[model samples]
Target: MSPAVSPPDARLPHRDARRDAVVDELRRLMARVEGVPKGREGALSFGLSALDQHLPQGGLAFGTVHEISTASEADLPAAFGFLLALLARTPGSAPLLLVLASKKLARCGLPHGAGLAALGLAPSRLTLVETENAAEALWATEEAVRARAPAAVASAIGGKLDLKASQRLHYAAREAGVPLLLLRPGETESVATAATRWRIGAAPGAQDRFGLLAGWRWHANLERCRNGEPRAWMLEFDHATHRFSLAAAVADPSLARGGEAPSLRRTG
Candidate 1:
């Protein structure tokens, strides 16, 4: 008798292949509908592969507002460092304006030219504006954005801003087609019309290429995004280059070679 024909294998891998194909097609369709501009006249890249993928328009929106806040007073420097790194990447020779509330300045101290230069910013290219309070600071930031004189506008507030105030700044930035960065202190979160919101704090120890203490590492959380999911990243700011880079997620402590972790140092 002829051998009975064996039944076709039931565990063939084609099932997975078919599922993957369907998923890929869905992603393509979603991207087409959601993808934002990427080149000049669009958004700015954060220079990190992980982050750009999650941001609306594939990067930070240019004609919109972004917010950054610290978890505590100690984290303020790291948050500010992250902002400075973004300013360093702004595309233009045009000076940028930094508006600060007088109360905020008294508490956080003024930004120094030398310190900014160390972070790859041209001190001369930064125009400082001081206001009496958060309300005035917000107004100045809006006006600066409307003026379009500076390449970007950044405002620092010592306290929280109401939703209406935040919306006004958002509209002004959009109207002028300039980016606006709002920096706030402490843990308070408010309803703001920002394209993205970030929470930043100091990370564990970080070492340079030579295994020596180099710069400060930060835990940056993408708290909110208009077109993407929230995510966290380990970001490092190199004093030598003043550029932000993705830090290794894990490292062997033994490789540090017995050097003590250095304190976070600021220039100026």
Candidate 2:
């Protein structure tokens, strides 16, 4: 007699059951890896109540890496400016470590002392680390984060960044209870473990009677955020306050002079 064989239709139930088991196991593993925060103790507020509400734990979480990138090459300056603003918002007075690749600096130019001061980050409180390449820059950033010396760490490394590298940095930040800010110019998607990812573009700034731009403005997109949905906002930086506010709400001389303001629309 021929060995008994299950018919294709009969095998369907077993296959379906196995698939469900695999899916359930995968979900459990993901949950274990992406552990939820216990509380809001490490949260860093954006100072905007509405923005804070959109972030996980009522604000940007510390002890994790937050990636910042530009919407395009042209927006690199805007993204860097935004990163400085965030550094100014870090909760402590410890010196900030800023790691930059030589190539990136050569291409984008160096961070200006005046600009840093304008963002409320005193140039004296920042430590600069120049690396030969992206890998070196990442290594320096990881070291700074692990040391737990800086109030916050930031790196501007433009080149290939893999998921594993990003995860390593994330783990270091978490272990040291420090926040790592990664500036990925040109906006690549290789970074996987960041607590949040922001994509920025230059927004029309408030102008004076002579058409000179005032405070920095950017169209920011929260592309990826854990525990929160993606959102976009036109934000303007208040140099004196080291805070962010809606661009439409900022007092614009042009607006007072009958210039139409940008619409505040919810975008992706």
Candidate 3:
């Protein structure tokens, strides 16, 4: 087998000094053994074979944290749509963990069921922990990361996240090695401690006599990364095939680019 990147040898919290040492060592090993290369050098496909070919390492870092948010309802479609494709790629046969900070929103299930049907995590296989508060949700996220059985863990939370809570979640996710996706509102702009932070927008899809059909679009204005940084691309998510195909520059008119505009079917 490929050599193990994380030894499973190091213990948690690593006696203070050892903590940074351990994180450093983990980064060193990740450089050598990682499935996802740092930065835009890789395409960041969600595990679709057709999708993987163009991307570096064929998929994203299995357990790293990737932050996501939209500026307004106008942008929510793209953000949520990108997430669906992401979840579609991540739902390996292993149980998946999804912690919903907006249980009342109910949009959490798009990926939980209909979207990721092909990824091996049926709705039944998904374990969702619902909470009303950020602090409480962060606690459960830590537990999920420790479990490590889930192929991925995601949280759809609105508004700014507490810096300390973000850091705690980062370390927990680091130990478990489960990739994380957090959904935040547009107005909220707390600097993320995650491996990478991204923004998503909506794209106008094909339309008939009906109103314009819009697809989800994504951009990578990475706030932080261990790898290289590249200019952002507004990606297109094709719902029919559950694929995240790339598009050119950042101009898609289907989605009103403004953060305050609303654009979504009331599936929630």
Candidate 4:
């Protein structure tokens, strides 16, 4: 009998290498223009290998804008929890700026202090600013970003955030070497200037032997990435460490096509 031959590998190593080189060059140019340093210092790793490995800079890049939106009105709390988790991971004691528009406040209400502590965020570390409208919220966020005083700036503004406004915020963040975490309405049009955009939905969490709940869980869908692939994951935030980890690989039907709202089961 003739010897059986193995098929050649189908992966295109050369193509991937070329693409990575181009991305690196672009990062260098952007670093020069933005006056921000290049390399690992400029990114914030999620501490989850599955996620960090897929990011262009190995994590969420600073000196830029990252947008997050809820899957539905009910998911606003989960989205806010996710934001607090992100802020908790930031490497600084500097006061965090949270700008909110009155319209959004009336719709979603304010963040709770006890919830902040439960999410590994210190209430004293956050500075809250409530604006009368979306315009004022955006203005406050832009000025805060330019000031470079806060470790990060978060804005929960309700309205149509056009590309130009997003670009201005992006540039301000870049110049200040800080991050602008913008929370948009679920149905708002996506902004192009954001380095990455996420849509977060509430998800079922794990239970202990006695059927006790484990931690906060969310369905995170990476809708857009400037230099990476779009993906989704079931994430759990550890309140103790303020880090994210992969939840059990339970299939979520709501994460299916067309972006349907997830039917979240309350643990309490």
Cα lDDT listed for each candidate: 0.72, 0.76, 0.57, 0.77
Considering TM-score, which of the candidate structures 1 and 3 is the better prediction for this target?
Answer: 1
Residue-level lDDT of model 2, residues 92-194, one tens digit each, is 6789999988464468788889978988888999999988877888889889998978988999878878888988887897777777888888857648888
Which of 2 and 4 is the better model by lDDT? 4
Q: In candidate 3, which residue ranges exceed 4 Å CA deviation?
A: 1-44, 47-59, 103-112, 115-121, 206-224, 248-268
Candidate 3 pairs with clashing backbones = 42-56, 43-55, 43-56, 63-177, 63-178, 63-179, 71-186, 72-259, 204-254
The candidate, 1 or 2, that scores higher on TM-score is 2
Stretches of model 2 off by over 4 angstroms after superposition = 1-33, 36-40, 208-212, 249-268
Tens digits of per-residue lDDT, candidate 4, 72-181, equal 88888788888888887777799999998746445766788998998888999999998888888888999999897999888887788888998899778887878788
lDDT score, residue 201, model 2?
89
* Residue 171 lDDT (model 4): 79
Q: Give the 10-residue window scoring lowest on summed lDDT in candidate 3.
A: 259-268
Give the per-residue lDDT of model 1 (tens digit) for 155-237: 77767678888878877777677888888767477546887888888876577679987877887777777656665666777
- Scored against the true structure, residue 97 in model 4 reaches a CA lDDT of 91
Question: Model 3, range 1-268, lDDT digits (tens) per residue?
Answer: 2444665645433554666577556755665564333342232355445334322234555556677776456676567656656765664477767777764245533344554554223677678788888677777777788787777788877656778778777766666667777777464575466555566665555333576544445553333444533224446655556555555343343342432323222111
Provide backbone clash counts, one per model: 0, 0, 9, 0
Which scores higher on lDDT, 1 or 3? 1
